[model samples]
Every structure is written in structure tokens, then in C-alpha cells.
Target: MHICHVNLASGFSGGERQTLTLIKQQLAMGYQLTVVANPKSPFADEIRALEQCQLVLCKHYTRSHQRSITADCDVVHVHEGRAIYWALLQRLIHGVPYIVTRRIDNPLKRKWLSQLAYTRASTLVGLSSEIVRQITLRHPQANVATIPSSPVQYPVSNTDVDAIKAQFANKFLVIQAANMYAHKGFDVTIGAAKELEKHSPQVHICLLGDGKARAELEKQAQGLGNISFMGKQSAMGNWFAAADLLVHPSYSEGLGSVILEAMATGLPAVGTKAGGIPDIINHETNGYLIPSGDQGEITYAQISVNPLIPASTICSK
Candidate 1:
């Protein structure tokens, strides 16, 4: 089938990465794949690398752009929120079937436009059960499907991994890789780190990824020697390999793909019991699950300081 993927995000994040993964898999399965993405986006650059996939550069999600790009496609698969509106427009104009992959746990605005976007789609895909529940709760008649995002196995060079290992050799490193957003729960992570600073001096918390809340989070974590912000990083494999554990304290999530990526890299995670985190982390088995918001302190304290072993090893025993 000819599948057209629409993602208008300008930056590369979990949603963009998921779009790349889906396109790659679809191409491998012999489907004719095309991507309609922003002209100056990382998603477009990566999609260009794949010779088999067709890339259509769209400066904006306009009706003319959507019509011209999706004319020959059998199915339109949208990967971002704004693209859903464009897809709905396409359905109205061209009689094309479109499916949307909603990746966030934020509630849809109670507006006619947002309501129509969800209700009129051919199918709505939620990255987690919680997201599905939220959508169905809002519009019971909406056809929602649950398909979690897949983790990409990053190819980190041995040199990079060894360098990270050497730099933080003495400290028991715990990494949290997510945009510094309020819902990402960096505040809870900072609070947990502050508490750990007084007691577990041996444990160091590294905050990866940057967003609007960086300055505020950094200020809140001041005078704490154990907590450090590493900013946005592309070489995540090195960090995962060097760290002893991963902690994701998001207040809301669609599916915690970072947790899955950490798990794939043999790092155990401590994620909050919010959104789709529970679907990825089996509490105390793969990782610990804490209550959302201010309840992370008690759960964070329960995690052992011992070096994390691979989940495969734990499963075998």
C-alpha cells in the first residue's frame, strides 16, 4: 500500500524518531512510503538518507501543500498534532483515509476544531493505554487504536562509551533524558536529586535534554553538587551505557520511549506511575515506578545504589 507520513515538527524528539522508525519498517515491508515534513527539519534529513523513501518538503501545512503531496497515496499517516488538522482537511477535500499517532498525554482542547480533528480521522492511534483512555473519554465515538512507540538501538561508538565511563567513573550515575518541561516532571527529579544529595552523595543525577525550563530547573537545583544538567544530546547510547540507572519523572506521558531505550541498553529505570510509564516499567522487576508529582522522594529512596545489571540477566535468574 502507498502510505504517506506527515510530520511537521521542526525539531527531533521522540515523536520524530517514532516517525522515522515507522517509515523504515514500512519501507522494509515493501510498502511505498512517502514523508511530508518541514523543509528544514531533522526528520526530513534522515528521511532523505533512505533512497527508497520519497521525501516531500512542506514549508507549512497548507491545504494546497497537503493536496499536492497526498494525491497519489492510499493512506495518510500523521505523526504530529498539527498534521492531524491538515489530514482532516485532506479527508474533506480528497476523500483520503488518514490515521493519526497522538504521542502526548495532554488533554485535547475542548474546541470544535480539536474535537473535529479527533472524531473525523479514519483512525486515531494512542502511543499508550492512558492516551487511548483519555481520547475515548473525550469522544466515545472516536475510533482509537493503541500502538506504542518503538525504541531505536543507537549506534554509539566504543570510544564514546569508554569516554563517558571514564569521566564519571567514581560516581554512581543516574540519567534522566527528557525535555525540561513541567509535565516531564523535571521538578520532581530535581527534588529527588536534592534529597539524594544530602544522603546518597555517591549517587549523581545527570539531566539530559534542554527546554524552556532549563534555567528554572538549574536554579532550583543550585548548591546541589550531585545534580548536573548535560543539555540536549544526540549520543544517548554513551550516556545510557555509562549510567547505572535511568529515572523518568514525567507528570504526563504518552509512552515513555526513553525508558524503553534505556531498558534496551541494559539500564534500569525509575519512572513515575503516570500515563504510559507502567506499560514500559514493571515495578521492581524491570524498574521502579513512583507516584507522580511530589511523591517521588519515597520511591527514589527505595532504589538501591548498587550498579544496575542487564534486565536479561535479572530475567534469566
Candidate 2:
């Protein structure tokens, strides 16, 4: 079966990476696959690098040019919102099955057009149960299935924890690894960090990932010595290993996969009780779930960071 995957976003992020991981696993299962992505996208080259996978380029997948995607393919799997137009056309024109992985939980998306697109999908995959519930609640007949995104790489191994801890030695580290989207609640974290800094001078917060809100978030951290923005890093494993805790203040999420990674690393997490986060994190067990927006510097300390599995076991696999 030829499964054609489509995601025409200009940039690559966690969702794109997770989609590639899924496709790679499916390819390993002996399915013939092709990836249709924007040629200019960073992910395009990577997809082309993969063995036995065809890479096709579409200029910009929009509703206007949807009919052009009717080319032969057994299944078309769309990774995000941008691929929806083409995916719908394929299903309508060629009667081909299409699956969509809705990666974001946007409250603003509660509209008739959104519901129509969602209800029309052959199979809709929601990253978190909360997303599934939201869809089913709005459009009762919406076909939705909950499938969590996979980890960055399975069998996470222990690597350079001592050196990482040494980077912020004698200081409490709270790491937030998310793009600077407004929904990510960076401003709230900044407020928390500021208050925490005043109470405990040794408390340090590290903000990772890049996005539109970076500039504003940096300004919010002004005069706050404890807060540091370490931009995006290719290797988040060491950062996750090094941190004393992980904090996610997102207003919503499809499923906070990073929370799972933090848990798998045995790092205790503190996050907002919104969207599918509650599904992965059992409050006070693996992490703490706080209220959204305007919450104070609720520091969660002395919690256990999940012990890393020895590298020997993972590498052997």
C-alpha cells in the first residue's frame, strides 16, 4: 500500500518530528510511503534522505489548489492544518482515505468551518483524549481517535547529567521547553519566576525553544537575573536530564508530549490543568497541575526527577 503523507508547513517543529517518527515506524513495518512537504521546509531534505521513501514537493497546499492533489495514492496522512485542503480533495475526488493528526488544541477553532473539516475526515487522530472529547462534543458525529505522539526517541538513555547539573550547580532549575506561543503561557511563567527569584535567589528558570513571543518573553524576564533564555537546542535530552523540574504553563495542548518525556526521564513536572495534559500527568504523582493564567510562583521542589535508564541497555537495542 502506498501511503502518501502530507504536511506543507514552512518550518519544522515537534509535531513535524513526531509525524516523521511515525512514518519511519510505518516504513519499518514494510509499507511503501511517500512524503509530500514544502520543498523549502527544513523537513523536506530530511524526508528525502530517508531510504525507500519518495519525496514530493507542493508549492503551498491551499484550498484554492486542492484539486491538484488527486494523484494516485492509497492513503494520505496529513500532519497539521495546512494539509487539510489537499487531504479533503483527495478523499472527495479519488475516494482515497485520509487521516489527519490534529496537533494543536485551539479554543478559537470552535467554528462551523473547523467542525466541517473535522467531521469530513475519514479518520481523525487527536493527540490527547481532551482533544477527542472537544471534537466529539462540538460535532457529535465527528470521527476522532486519540493517539498520543511518540517520544523523541524511544528507550531514552542517561547522558551527561553531572555536566548538565554542573552548568547550573547549586541552583534550582526549572526548564520549560516550548515555542513562544501566547497559549504557551510564558508571561505567567515569567511572573512565577520573578516571584520565585525574589523569595529564593538561587531559583533559576531556563526557557527553551523559539517563536514569535520570544522578544516579549525576554522583556518580561528583564531585571530578573534568575531567568535565562537558552534559545533552541538540538539536543534536549541533556537539558531534560539536567533539570530539577519541568514546568508547562500552556493554556491548551493536544497532548503535552514533552510532559511524558519529562516523566520518562523521571523529572517531576508542574503544568496547567488544561487540554490533554491531565491525561499524561497524574497530578502530584508524576507532576503538578496548576491553574491557568495569573497563577503565582508556585514552586514545586524536592520532587523526584525520573531516574535515567542506563545507556548500555538502550544502545544495545
Candidate 3:
């Protein structure tokens, strides 16, 4: 089958990573794969690296649709919101079958229009059961499929892992690998770090990834010397391996891909008990989930800083 995937966002994030993983997996399985994206995007470069794949440079087609995109492929698998408009347009204009993957927790709040837009799609794939439930609750008759965004086949280099491990050797490092967003609770993670310092001076918090909320998060971390903002880095597997634990205190999440990535590296996870996290993270098994918002700080800090719990226990589950 000829499958084409499209997303407009430039930088690499969870959704972008998911797109790359799906495309690579499909290509390995002998499917004809092509990506419709910006030539300058990391997605474009990654897709082009695949010998079996083809890429079409259609940068600004996100807001509206073009007949050419849907005409050539048998199946159009769309990821991210920008591609959703294209998916619906294809169905209305070209009679092409398409599937969308909803990877984020907060579905747009505009109910009627959002419902209409989603119901019009051929099939909607939710990255977590909570997302599927939310969609069904909104449009009772809407068709939504549940599929966990599987862990990436993370490449681990021993040299890289050792280097990062040495950088934060003495500190009991707590890392949060999430985009810099309000919903991601980077502020909350920093708050927890500051609160933890009152009782435990040895604990340290590292915020990973970059986003619009960087300035605000940095401002919040100002007085908190234990909290360090590392910004965005392409190499994360080694950091995941080096960190004492991973904490995801999002107000909402589709599946918390970082949680699985941390678990795969034998690192424990501490996240808010919301969305798809419950489906994968067993309380006191691989990780701990706390209530959303302010209450999460206390719960997350305690779980993350605990010395009794070993990171190795996370991978076993």
C-alpha cells in the first residue's frame, strides 16, 4: 500500500517523532512511503535518509489543501493539527481514505466545530484510551481507534551515555523531557524542585526541550538554584539513561511518550495521573501518577526524590 504522512511543524517533538517512527516502520515492512512536508524540516531530512521513501516539498499547503497531495497516494495518514485540514479537504475533494492520529491530551475546546471536523474524518486514532473516551464523549457516534504511541527504537551509544552521566555525577538528577508549554507543567516541575530544596538539598531538576513558555519557565527557575533549564537537545537517550528519574506533570497528555522512553532506559517515571499515563504506568510499579495541577508538585517531588526506589524497577514492568 502507498501511504503518505503529513505534518507542518518544523522542529522535532513527540508528534514529529511518531511520524518518523511510523514512516520508518512502514518502509521496513515494504510499503511505498512518501512524506509531504517542508524541505527544511527535520522530518524531511529524516524521511529522505530512507532509501525506499520519497518526499514531496509542499511547505505552505497546511492552511488549505491541494488536489495533488491526495491524488497520488492510496492512503494518507495525517499527524498534527495542520495536516487535519488537508485530510478533510482530501476526503471532500478527492475521495481519498485517510486516518488521523490525535497525539495530544487537550482536544480543542471549541465543541461544535471540533466535533464536526473530527466526525468528517474516515477514522480517528487516539494515542491514549482517555483521548478516545474524550472524543466519544463529545461525539457519541464518531469513530475513534485507540493505539499507544510505541516507544521509539532509541539508539544508545555507550560513550554518549557515559559523558552525560559524568556531567551530573554527584547530583540526584530529576529530568523532565517535555516541550516548553503551560500544559506540560514545566513551571510546576520547577516549583517542585524549589519546594524539594527546603527539605532535601541534594535534589536537582533539569527541564529539557524548548517551547514558547521558555522565558516564563526560566523566570520561575531564577531563585531556584537546583533547577536547570537545558533547552532542546537532539540526543536524549543518554540523558534518559543518566538521569535518576523522569517526571511528566502535564495537565493532560495523549500517552506520555517520554514515560515509555524513560522506562525503556530503566528509569522510573513520576507523572500526573491523567490521560493515557494510567493505561501504561502502573502506580508503584514502573512509575507514580499524581493528581493534576498544584497537588501534583508534592506528589511528584516526593516520588522523584525517593532514595528507596531504584530506576531499574521501571523497565521490568
Candidate 4:
């Protein structure tokens, strides 16, 4: 089957990474694939690099040009939220069928335009059960499916891991890899880190990824020697290998892909009981699940010291 994937996001994030994975796997299976993305986005650059895939650059993916780009494809797969509207337009203009993948747990607006988009989709895929429930509640007649995001795996040499460990010697490393968004709850993480410092001076918190809230979060974490901001690092596996635990205090999430990545590295996580975190983390078994923005203290003693599994074992399942 010929599938055309549509994603209009300019920045590279979890959704874009998932789209790239799907394109690569489908092409390897002897399926014809095409990707419609912004001309200037990193996603388009990666798609252009693939030999068997076709790349179509649409700056806005406007309605007038949708038919020309997707007319020959058997299925239109929308990977991002903005592309849903474009798919709806194509379905109306050229009688094309399209499916949407919803990646966020945010509630859909109850407006007529949003409702029409959901109701008209051939299929709606949610990354987690919570997202599926929200979509079905908003539009009862909408066709929805649940398909989780794939786990991310990367190689980390023992030399690299040892180097990182030496850099943060005599410290219990705790890492959180997420953008500095309010919904991500970085403030809550800082608060917990501050309290933990008062008791366990050996505990160190590393904040990964960059966002608009970086400066503000840095200021909030000021005068706290235990907390450090490392900005965005391309090689995340090295950091995961160096860390003892992962803390994801997100207020909202469709599914926590970072948590899965941590699990794949045999690192236990301490995430909030929000969205799909509970689905991946078995509380007290694999990791700990705390309430969102809870003022209660979390110490190194609360974190699990046992390794879950090797990277290959977790990824294979």
C-alpha cells in the first residue's frame, strides 16, 4: 500500500521522531511511502535522506495544494494536530481517506470545527488510553484506536558512561529530559530537588532539553548546588547511562516516551501519576509514581536501586 504521512511541525520533537520511525519501517517492508512536511523543517531533511521514500515540501499544506500532493496515495496518515485540519480539507475536496494520530492528552476544543475534524477522520489513533478516552468523550461517533509510540534505543559505550560517572562523582544522579514547558512541570521538579538537597546533599538533579522557560527555571533553581541545567544534548543515552534514576513530573502527557527510553537503559523512573505514565511504570515494581506537583518530599531512599532490564530486553518487548 502507498501511504502519505503529513506533519507540518517546524521543530523536531517526539512526534517528529515517531513519524521518521514509521516511514523507515514501512519502506523496509516494501511499501510505497511519501512524507509531506515543511520545506525548512528538520523532518523534511531526514525524509529527504531516505533512499526509498518520496518527500513533498508544503510550507503550509494549504487546501488548494493538498490534492496534488496526496491524490495518488492509498492512505493519508496525519502525524500532528495541525495536519488534521489539512486532512479534513483533502477528504472534502478530493474524497481521500485519512487517519489521525493524537499525541497529546490535552482536551479537544468543543467548537464545531474541531468536532468536524474528529468526526470526519477515517480513524483516530491515540498514543495512550487516556487520550483515546478524551477523544471518544468529545466525539462519541468518532472512530478511534490506541497505538503507543515506539521505544527509543541508542548505544552508549562503557567508556562514555564511566566518563560521565567520574564527572559527577560522589553524587546520586537524577535526570529529567523534557522541554521547559509549564505543562511539563519543571517547577515541581525544582521544588522537589530543593527539598531533597536539605537532607541528601549527595543527590544531584540534571535538567535536560531547552525551552522558553529555561531562564525562569534556572532562576528558580538558583543557589541550589544540587541542581544543574545541561540544555539540549543530542546524545541522550550517555546521560541515561550516567544517571541512577529518572524523574518526570509532567502535569500532562499523552505517553511518556522518555520514560520508556529510560527503562530501555535499565534506569528506574519516578514520574507523576499523570496521563499514560502509570501504563509504562508499575509502581513499586519498576519505578515510583508520585502525584503531580505534590509538596511531599522525595528522597533517594524512595527511588528503586534495582535495574529493570537491559536495553535489548526492554526494546524487544
Candidate 5:
């Protein structure tokens, strides 16, 4: 079987990483694979060296020119938002059916083209049940399936973990790993850190990721010593292994796979009820879920996560 994966993201992020993982697994399973991505994007660089996977550069989804590959494909899999129209066009012109994996819970525009593209797809997969619900709400006839993104469980040496722990010694590490985007709700973290600094001097918030919003978020955290932003780090597993808690207060989320990664490291999470965070977090059992963009709730949640406490009981609703 042949599978053509399309991911036209401008930069590398969680969704692109998931797409890359899927392509590698499918190729290993003896499925011929082709990937459509931005030539300059980090995702393209990662996929470029993969054996048996044909990397087709589609800088812009609309201007894509891959009719020959579409003709030979057994299945067309769209992995991002802009690629939906590209796959729809291929299905219309070449008669190749495509399935879309919608990675976001943001509602689709109520337009004819958006409706047509979704309804025409062979299947629409959501990273979580919440995303599935959002898809159905946009188009009731939309065929949707829920398949959560898998965690990588990145390998890390004990030395790296110990080093990270030593860097933040004597502090209850509250970590957040996500692109510093506005929708990621960095404001909530800043607010929570500001409040926590007043009472819980031992609690420290460490954000690990960088984006256009970094400067703005830094300004918001002005005069705060309890919070620190370390640009993007390659040693995610080391941080998770060292951290006491992971707080993801995203205003909008697809599946919150970072939460899953933290859990894989035996680190608990305090995520917002937004999007598919509720899918993985069991509310006081595994982790906690609070209102999206609630600064006070985040502050309270961080204070509750005692570093001395074992990984067994982490957070609550």
C-alpha cells in the first residue's frame, strides 16, 4: 500500500512531529510513503533524510504541483489545516480519496469551501474526542475518528536529569513545554508565577520553548524571579524527569500530547479543561484539570504540587 502524507506547517511543532512519527512507522511497515511539506520548514529537514520516504516540497498548499504522485497514491492523508484544500483538489482532479487528520479543536469557518472539503474527505481523524466533537459541530455529516497522538518517551541520561535538577536545586520545579504562542496561554503562567512568588518562594516555573510571543511574555513576567524562560531545548526528557509538575494552560489545544510525555516520565500535569486535555488527565487521579486562562487556579495548582510528594499523587481538578 502507498500513503501520501501532507503536512504544510511553516515551522516544526507537535503536529509535525506526530506526522513524522507516523511516516516513519508506515515506511517501516513496508508502505510506500510520500510527504508534502514546506521545503524550508524544520519538518522537511527531518523527513528529507528518511529512507524510502519521498519528500515532495509544497511550499504553499494552494500552489502545490504533485499530480503525478497523487495519481500513484493509494491513500492521501492530510495532516494540517491548509493541506485540507490541497487534498480536496487532488481528490477532485485525480480521483484519489483523502482522509484528513484535524489536529486542532478550533472550529472551522462556516463557509461553503470548508464544508465541501471536510464532507468530501473519506475520513476525518481527530487527535482527541474533543477535537472530534468540534469537527462534528462544524459539519454534522463529517466522518470523524478519535486517535490520540502518541508520546515519544525520549531517552535521557541520568547525568542530564541530575544536571537539570541541580540547575533548579531547592525549588519545586513547575515546568511547561510548548511553543510560546499566544493561544498557549503564557499569560496564565506569568500570572500564576507572579502570585506564587508572593507565598510559595520555593516554587519555580520553568517554560521550555520559544516563539514570537516570547518577548511579550517576558515583559509580562517583569520583576519576577520565580519564573524563567529557557529557549527551546533538545533535552525534553531530562527536564520532565527532573521536574515536579507540568502545567499546560492552553486556551486552545488539540490533544495535549506534552501532558502524555510528562506522564511517561512519571511526572504529573495540571492542564486546562480546554480541548483534549481532559482525555488524558483523570482529574485528581492522574493529574488535574482547571479552567482555561485561570491565573489564580494555576497559582493554586502549583502550590499544591509539593516536590517532596511522590509522583503518585500530583494534582486535582
Candidate 6:
């Protein structure tokens, strides 16, 4: 079967990573694949690298709606919120069935366009129950599917892991990997790092990923010795292998894919009790979950990471 995947995100993050993972598996199953992406999206490069895959470049917003996108595909899979417009356009113009996977738990707008998009899709896939709840609460008649995103085992390089280990030597590295948005709780992580400085000096917080919020977040971290910002990284597998622990203190979240990625590397996480994090983190087992935006609780979770959970990971689950 031929599948057309649409992800019009400007930057590559958890959702984009999930899209690539799905495409990789489908390719192995001998399915024909076509990816519709932004011209400047970093995600496009990964699709181009895959053999037997067709890459279609489309501008963000309205321009993503093209006849060629859904012309020859069996089904259109929309990966991001903005791509919903493109999928609906194709369905309207070509009579193709489309599926939308909602990655964020943010409430759907009551506006006509959003209602129309949500209502018109053949299937609405939510990465977490919370995401599903949001849509069903709005468009009660919409067909929603509770399909959680799975984690991929990244190819780890010993050399890459060694380099990260060498840089943060002798320090208990607790990394938080995600796009630097205000709601991501970067500030809370920084605050926790500061609170740890007086007591657990060996514990360090490394904020990974980048975005427009980086500059301001960096300013907030100024003069803080226990925290450092590692801008947008490509080798996530390597960093996960080298880190001692992972923390995701988002004020809000969908499923917290970063926790799954870290778990794949046998690295346990201390994610806040928000969104779908509860789905991944089994308290005192693979990892721990604290109240969101609670600096004191965040610090406690980091300092109290079990020494034995590393032997088993949630990757299998």
C-alpha cells in the first residue's frame, strides 16, 4: 500500500522523530512512502536519505495543500497540527481518506476551521489519552483512536558517548531533552539546578534542544554553575547513553517522548506528573514522576534516582 506522510513543522522534535520512526518501519515492510514536509524542515533530510521514498516539498500553511500530495497515496497521515489543513484540502479536492495524529494535549480550538478539520478526518489518533480526551471533549462525534507513540532504539556510537562523558566528567549529569519552549519548564529545571547547587553540588542539569525561547532561557541560566544548555543536538542516542539521568519537568506535555528515548538507552527519567508522562514513568520502577513545575520536587527526584533501575529499562514496555 502507498502511504503519504505529512509533517509541516519548521523544526524537528519528538513528533518529527516519531514520524521518521513510523516511516522507517513501513519501508522495511515494503510499503511505498511519500513524505510531505516543509522546504526548510530538518525532517526532510532524513526522508531523503531513505531509499524508495518520495520527498515532496511544500511551504508552511496553505501552500502545503497540493494535488500531487494525495493524488496517488492510499491514505494520508498527518503528523502535526498545521499539516491538518493540507490533509483536509487534499480530501476535499481529491476525495482521499486522511488520518490526523494529534501530538499535543493543548485543547482544540472551537473555531470552524479546526472543528472542520477534526470532524473531516477519517481517524484522529492521539499520542496519549489526554490528547484524545481534548478532541473528544470538543468534537464529540469525531472518530478518535488511542494510539500511543512508541520509542525507537537509537544506534549508539561508543565514541560519541565517550565524548559527552569526558566533557561532563565526575558530574552527575541529568539531561532534559526537548524544544526550548516556555511551557517546557526550562525555567523550572534551571530553578531546580540552582536549588541543588547548595546541597547536591555533584548534580548538574543539562538542558538540551533549541528554539526561539533559547536566548531568554539562557539568560535565566546565567551565572548558574550547576546548569548548562546544550543547543539542538542530532545524536540523541549518544547523549542518552552517556547521561546518568533524564528529567522532563514540563508544565504541560502530551506523552513525553524524550523519556521513552532515554529509557531506550537504559537511562531512567524524572518526569513531571503531567500529560502522558504517567503512561511512561512507573514511579520507583523505571523512573520517578514529581509534580510539574515543583522545583523542590524536581530536585528531590534527581537526587533520589535509584541506583538499580538502570539494569532494566522501559524500552521493552
Each candidate structure's TM-score, on Cα atoms with residue i matched to residue i, is: 0.92, 0.85, 0.88, 0.91, 0.92, 0.91
Model 1 poorest 10 in a row by lDDT: 308-317
- Tens-place lDDT digits, model 5, residues 202-263: 88889899999999999999899999999898778889889989999999999898998899
Error of 5 at 221 (Å): 1.1
TM-score winner between candidates 1 and 4 = 1
lDDT of 4 by residue, 18-83 (tens): 888888888889999878888778989999899677787777756335566777889889975678
Q: Which ten residues in a row have the lowest lDDT in candidate 3?
A: 308-317
lDDT of 3 by residue, 68-179 (tens): 6556788788885767766666677777777878887765456564555577877888888898887777667867889898788677788998887677777778888888
Question: Across residues 1-317, which tens digit of lDDT does each residue of candidate 1 receive?
Answer: 89989988888888888888888888899999878888778989999999898888876767345466777899999975678877888888888888988887878779898788777888888889998888888888888899988888787788988887787778788888998888898888778777666656767788998999999998999898888889999989888888888888888888899999999989888888899999998887888877888634533432453444223322211
TM-score of 5: 0.92
Error of 2 at 260 (Å): 1.7
C-alpha lDDT of candidate 3 relative to the true structure: 0.76
**What is the C-alpha local distance difference test score of each model?**
0.81, 0.75, 0.76, 0.81, 0.86, 0.84
**Cα RMSD, each candidate:** 4.2, 7.0, 4.3, 5.5, 2.9, 4.6
Candidate 1, RMSD to the unseen true structure: 4.2
Task: Summarize candidate 2's per-residue lDDT along 1-317 as a digit string, tens digits.
Answer: 77889888878787788878888898899988878788888888778888678777886755333443435567788876768767776666667778878776754266675555566778888888887776666666767788998777534245566776777888878888998899998888888776666555666789988899999888888899888898986677888878888888888777888888778777778888888888887876766777777445244331223223233322110
Please name the candidate that would achieve the greatest lDDT relative to the true structure: 5
Error of 3 at 239 (Å): 0.5
For lDDT, candidate 1 versus 2, the one ahead is 1
TM-score of 1: 0.92
